[model samples]
Target: MIKVLIVDDSALIRSLLKEIISKEPDMMVVGTAPDAYAARDMVNRFTPDVITLDIEMPKVDGITFLDKLMKARPTPVLMISTLTAKGADATLKCLELGAIDYIEKPKIGVTEGIEAYRQIILEKVRTAAVSKVARRTSTPATVKQQSIISGTEKIIAVGASTGGTEAIKAFLLALPANAPAVVITQHMPPGFTRSFAERLNNLCKVNVSEAKGGERLLPGYVYIAPGDIHLGIEKSGADYRTVLIDGDRVSGHKPSVDVLFQTVSKTAGKNAIGIIMTGMGKDGAAGLYDMRQSGAYTIAQDESSCVVFGMPGEAIKLGAAMTVCHLDNIAKTVFDYLNVTGSGSRL
Candidate 1:
């Protein structure tokens, strides 16, 4: 059975979570904590396989508690947050600090909505139970930063889901402005991807935006696949362009990593670099395999740094990835492989 610890300050919320989780035959609420202090204590006692953490609580907030928990005893943590803008930002921060996933709390006067949220919460919990929990590692403070490539251009296609929001952010923030033309497919809702793209644009040095059909692929710009559509890269003579395909969902996702990777493999061929980041399910594995077979460099985030190793793990098992890297090192690894001075460079 999958064991869980529920941490929230609200008594009603805690009771509601308990009721929802208890209904699952293969999962159980092993413990409940009102605040971070109680949570820390319970961690030592129950040793749960996963945790459902609230972003807001008395004494210590969720983000702070998450950082502490990851530092002390890293485990899969699913954040429970409100649907407000502020809540979204906080929940995103939690993902950065190693939270596996998050679910928005139901709003007041939405009794039926709360029930729906309960189902989502349970599903997220079950998913988290099977995900990989990254352990905290200490790095030297004086580690030298690597230099960016002076002049090089290549196509970089990235796909992710579940814990991808923060994983992609962390990976992209390490990239230089002149890195490459990046096409990203992150599983997100309609309005959410736009907000996520805007957030990435603000956080990273590159120009990040939602991908539009037939747009010219340009360097220093990142195109995120819009929700409910498949993003593909099309070739035009010597230049490559973006193509958004509207079709049935592949592998249970619209903007599937498989679809994006397959298109990149066919269009860009050996000129592309495919990256599969942290996520649940096997959406990108087969496509990443195809990318590798087509001579495009493929990389998968290692199990040690993934919230859900399902995608990358599947790719690794299929021998699709040339190298498996930790989340913190994935960007550098990609840069190293694509650097103009390096042997793997196509430009």
Candidate 2:
């Protein structure tokens, strides 16, 4: 059985989390704590396989606790946060600090919301239990635009889930200022994507922003799919445009990687480059295969470098990936492909 520890400042939240987790047949809540101090004690006694940590607390915040925990024990952590701007920022920091993932507290109907998302919460806990936790690592040297052969017209499409934030950051930070246009779906909720995109924009050379429908795709820019919406690509005259759709969850997620990859295959065809990174499940597997069959270059993040290795592994199994590579090599590989093929140069 999967053992879990709940760390929160609220008795109510702790009880609610326990109730939700206890319903899972494969998992059990080993203990609960109302603060980080109590949580530290529980961690020693329970030795849980996973932890659900709340961001707000009376004394030590979740971020500090996570940093300490990763440095010491390296246990998989899933953060619980309020659906606010500060909460979003803190959650992103937690991810960078080696937390596995996060779930936002409902703003309106707390009970109903928790019940509605029970499955997702359980799935995250299961993924966290089996996740690979390691010390934080930095990206390699910055990308040089001049070194990349000019006139590569490639449009890159990427999809990720579980452990994607850090993976995507490393890939983008290594891109040149004139890198090809890129679009992504990272399986985040609304209100969080804007903060994520803004954070990426501040850190990376590429101009990254949350996608708003109808924007023309351009080089040197990366558009991230907004939460709770589906983002697609379409051919418009001599250029490509972003299409945002609000529909039922495809592959159990809004802004699914499958949706993005399918759209890219249909719209950009051989001009696109598809990449599936570290994530849980097979959301992008078949769509990536379509991209490969349509003559686009496809790559998967290799198993050793993946946090979960589910999505990319499925893609590799399905013959969707033309090549599988480490996270550090992905940027250079994409650039090398651009240098050689120049797929989108004439478009």
Candidate 3:
């Protein structure tokens, strides 16, 4: 059976979680805590397979508590967050600190909708239980300054979901502006992708923006796929550009990573590098396989460093990845690959 711990300040919330989880034959709520202090105690005693953590609490907030837990014990954690803008931001931070996934709190009179949340929670917990956990330490100076190649018109394609927001940040912040042009597909709600891109742009040296139709793929700039459409890469004579394809969902995601990776394989071919980060599904595995078959180098985040190892693990199992890397090493690995090949022109 999968053991779980629920850490929330609300008694009602805790009770509801227990009720929901108890219905599953293979899962059980082994412990409950009102705050991080109690959570630590439960961790020592219960040794749960999963933790459902709340963002707001007295004495210790969820983000701080999660950081401590990951540094110490490193179990999978799912966040319970309020459905406000502030809550979304805080939950994003939690994902960065290594929480596996999150469920939004149900609104008043919308309790029936919570069944979906319960299902998502249960599914994430089960998936998290079997995933590999990589040991994470502070970024080393050598990794921060690593470069791929001196002068290549390089392109990096990244795909992520679930716990990707923070994973992307951790990887990108370590990248230099001169690295390459980058295209990213992160599973997100509408309006949030732009905000996320803008936030990353401000924090990192490279330019980051939400992709628009026909935008040129320029060095030192990162284009994020819009939430509701598929973003593809196209080559026009000597220049590569973004193409937004508005269509039905592919693999249950609008901007599916498979679609993006397939496009990159066709357009950039051996000149590109594909990085599949942490996420909860198999969206990118087939496309990543295509990229590898086309001679583009590919890397998958290792199970230990992933929020959910589903996507990368699938890719690795399928022989799509050339290397399985930890989150802190991913940026440096990209640079190292590029440096050996010189750049796009050389390739």
RMSD after CA superposition, every candidate? 4.1, 1.9, 3.4
Give per-model TM-scores.
0.80, 0.95, 0.83
Candidate 3 pairs with clashing backbones: 133-304, 134-304, 148-335, 148-339, 149-339, 152-343
Better of 1 and 3 by TM-score: 3
**Worst-scoring 10-residue span by lDDT in model 2:** 144-153
**Which residue segments of model 2 deviate by more than 4 Å?**
106-110, 145-152, 343-347
Clashing pairs in 1: none
| 1-347: candidate 1 lDDT, tens digit per residue | 98999999988888878888888899989999999999999999999998999999989999999999888888899898776657766776787678888877655455867766776787788888887664434431221235544233378899999888877887777777766789999987565677788888997877899898887787678899987699998887667789999999998888999999999998877878999998888999999999999989999998877777888888999999998988888877776765444344334
Q: Give me the candidate number with maximum TM-score.
A: 2
Q: Model 1, stretches more than 4 Å misplaced? A: 9-13, 33-45, 58-60, 71-73, 106-123, 130-132, 135-153, 236-238, 339-347
CA lDDT scores, all candidates in order: 0.82, 0.88, 0.83
Kindly provide the TM-score of model 2 when superposed on the true structure, using C-alpha atoms.
Answer: 0.95
Instruction: Look at candidate 2 and tell me the lDDT of residue 154.
Output: 65
Number of the top-ranking candidate, with lDDT as the measure: 2
* lDDT string, candidate 3, 57-174, tens digits: 9999999999999888998888888756577678767766667777765453467768777787788778778754434446433344343443334679999987788778887788
Clashes of each: 0, 2, 6
Error of 1 at 63 (Å): 2.7
Q: Give lDDT: candidate 3, residue 295.
A: 85
How good is model 3 by TM-score? 0.83
lDDT of 2 by residue, 183-299 (tens): 999988888899999999999988999999898888888999998899989888888889998898888889889999999999888889999999999999999999999989999
> What lDDT would candidate 2 get against the real structure?
0.88
